[model samples]
Target: MPIFNQSIRRKIVGIALGLIVLMLVTSILSMVMSSQVGILLDELTNRYIPAYGHLARANIRSLERSVALRRMVMMKMQAPSEEEAYAARLREFEEADRKIDDEAEAARTLINAIIDDSRTPSDNAGLARIETRIETALTELRQAMNEDHAKLLKQVDDKQMTEVRGTLEHLDTLRDQFNQRIDTIRADMLKQVFASTRTVIGRQHQAIVISAIVTVLAAIVGFAFALLVSSGITRPVRLLLAGTREVEAGRFDKTITVSTQDEIGELAAAFNRMTEQLRHNERIRETFGRYIDPKVVQGLIDRPEVAIDGERRVMTIMFCDMSGFTSMSEGMTPRGLVRVMNHYFTVMSGPIRGNRGIIDKYIGDAIMSYWGPPFIEEDEQALLAGIAATEMVDQVPALQKQLPDLLGIRAMPAPCDLRIGIATGEVLTGSIGSELMMSFTVMGDAVNLASRLEAVNKVYGTRILISQATADAIGARLELREIDHLAVAGQSAPQPIFEVMARAGALTGAQDSLRAHYAEALAAYRARRFDEARAAFNAALEAVPGDGPSRTMLGRIAQFEAKPPEEGWDGAWRLEQK
Candidate 1:
């Protein structure tokens, strides 16, 4: 049988045998060089770095010992009669002495390790002698200082000031001697460190020279081998490269021509299959985009990871409900009700989307939406949400006018207005629900608070109620009136709520006075001064007659006079309703 008829693996091995032999020779030479370099690196890490580090630490400890000794002698001479102070200084001096000995011992231990690892252990005998000399000097200095410290304490106890001064002067000399010995040891160790560094550098240079000679020989052989093999496959490779470029440029209508019967031919066949799949995916993407929002569909396509996992982020949420919707829908036929709702949604959704808010869902007459990152910028979410809510309220009159015509009636039986609530806080956002039926939405305290605030509007008779977090986010951009601090049902902490009055600098004169008087009244009521609270609240009513919040406070004050609240009332109205 012909050799070409054998398996492709055997054919490739036969063709490249010369190259394989060359590679083996090169690999063996590399391994030998690697072993030598690795030994040098091991010494660098285990001996040189460690020994240098310990010596440096010994030097620092020696300096600290000098400082501690001087402080001890000064404190003793100044307060020689104070026994308690003298004892504390003595402890400090002992701790310093212990640290100096420990560091010196650590350096000596590392030097011993280096000696054992050395090719010529006798060469380090000089280092050993210097270390011994330094140790002896430190010991003598410590003994002399200890003796003088004891005598100084005795003289202080005996009230002999003259003798105590003399002992302190002796201790100062001992501190100087101790520093000199440590310096000598440090200088010797430094010389050894430099010598080791030079030795490592020399070995590194030798390794590099040997490696270069071997590498040059191997490269020449490898180059000749590569040229022999590459000549046979160049044509097919160029064909495959051209086909890939076409596919990358979105021209998937072509297939690579397979001219070989080897692995290259199989690869070409696979490339054709991949191009066909790419064309099919493009068609599917176009069709899928029509059923889903282009932005949402592209998001899923671009980031498959976010499709299943949820992320926690700070977001602004809004809930808007049509007032008197239940009664308004009672008289309308189902068809007419659907017409009104569709138009209402069409009109309301404009502001939200225009302001970069996501309309999450529509629940009968209510709309839930949110603004946050990945969909909108974080810093602008709150302001966008507030703008959308205010715009929705502003469009209510136009919506009311259009309602009668849409229902084909002379006049609507029930009037319509908006009650909106906005809040900013952390919420979990992602695809929610079972895998079979999932929807992208936000779920957390912020969403619930927004819903509760929408309900609270009925009690306050306010158009919009916003949490303090939301108000703070929209600072200097919108005019706001403090409504009340309320602990809504299912929550423990009282949140201060506010009403959106108008754009900043747009509040009418009368409205501004109403806000001022109500703030004063609310403060008094919180202070538990019912009589003053009542007067201020009455004045607020005069400024804006039929003010719901002001009237609410007045009625509460009457009840408080009859039966006051329990002790520790923080002036927050705890709502029992959901």
Candidate 2:
């Protein structure tokens, strides 16, 4: 039941633990081997070798000092003209001799220590040779010194002096021989020590090689075990992963059949159950989409988890209704009406989606969509939705032609024209309905205004009507005609609305002139120049009689000029309805 016991994870953990233990053991073995090597080196260098070298060096220094002192004594015995000078030189020689004797004793003690401790025959023989040399040097130096003293006491006789010189020479030769012998002993002892050190180092090297080979072998064995353990986990886990991917891709028939009675098997069972539930859900989605848009249904389905609450985002809402659809449907069979409606919805939905607007819902003979809410890019959404509306209106003529051939039903020469109403404003958008069944939709004053604008398109004989807010959002890219200021049906305020005719390039010269006159009238009205505003409005009507905005402005100017309302009143119009 432990979490780490989960199939693939357990194998990984086991392998990691094994590798860590192996490394720890190998490191400990290496440390033990290194420590043994270090101890052997310490014994050879710090114990017998240094002791032998130290004694040999001490003996050589003592011999050299003794010879120098004896020569000085001889010089003093020959050259002393004054008693004081002779005594000073004699004292110097005596002090030097005392130092020499002290040094020799120290050397003898060190050599004896070496002889006692040395295990090798060569080392013991070297120490013995050094000891004998020290003794011979000491004896020769003493005899030479005594002879010089006797000669000095005999009042500097020639024959005695010659004998003294010969003895001094003999003493020097003896000292030289003693020093050579000590040097040989030092060399021999060093050679023996080096040989021992080399042997110990060779053993240490062999130990290191053995340790490295063992570590490698252990790693190989551990890796094999790790792979075996990992296989038991990875094989089933890989199957599970592959099966999960297939399920994601809608391969519901694919099943994971891993039969290990481990946690992997449990996962495989759980995955199968999950896939079954997904299959049921998919069937529900298909059935639901037959009645409503799948996108809307999906939006509703995703709402709870995503918390798709309403947001106050600037958006363009579009409402399109088939003109005279009620009358048209009344003349057809129920099946025929349904078929035509489906065709209409299909054609319209493409442009809406292509323009990046989500189709919120479709009432009978009408489609409602919006630019924002689950997602939005204000200027781009407004412009594209406007463009899509224009494109849909243009396609109406072609759709009328294709209908008869595709449906095997004689179509009306002029099918009901689409009246599109676009408005931009803040709207509440998300899922709204009972828990048993809900729908994704947008609702607010903006959506209502768009609906009302579609209705007003009947009054203006316009194909597409858009609010000023949408017009402003769309900017100069779309060609528009000032439609009317209408108190659309449900509200107290009137909104200025325009009919989008085409993109800028599609406007005719007359349409352009009417737009220009309407702009002048609107500007004059805003300046509160009732007379000039009326004149401009009349000019717009001359160019396009059905200019809805001009007619609305003319009515406002007449009402104001009659009573000449408040002196400070600006001619700004307001929509009193939705």
- Return the top candidate by TM-score: 2
Task: Please give, for residues 355-453, the per-residue lDDT of candidate 1 as tens digits.
Answer: 978788889899998898787788899888888888888899999999999998889998899999999999997798886888777899999999999
| Candidate 2, position 375, lDDT | 56
Measured against the true structure, the TM-scores of the candidates, in listed sequence, are 0.51, 0.53
RMSD of each: 37.1, 13.3
lDDT of 2 by residue, 1-578 (tens): 24234556565776888888888888888888777676666666665476565546655555655555555545555643445655665566566566556655666665576467533223567667766766676676667656755654453434366666665666567556656665665566567677667867786897789798979988898888777666666777898899888987878877777566567878888888888888888889899766666666666666664335655667788999988677666667677777888888899888988877787778888998888645555668789889989989988987777666655667664457889899888877656788898766677888988998887776666789998898888888998776555667776666678888789788888788888988888888878787888898899889888776577668877887786767755443444444
Candidate 1 — which residues are off by over 4 angstroms? 1-295
Candidate 1 lDDT score at position 336: 98
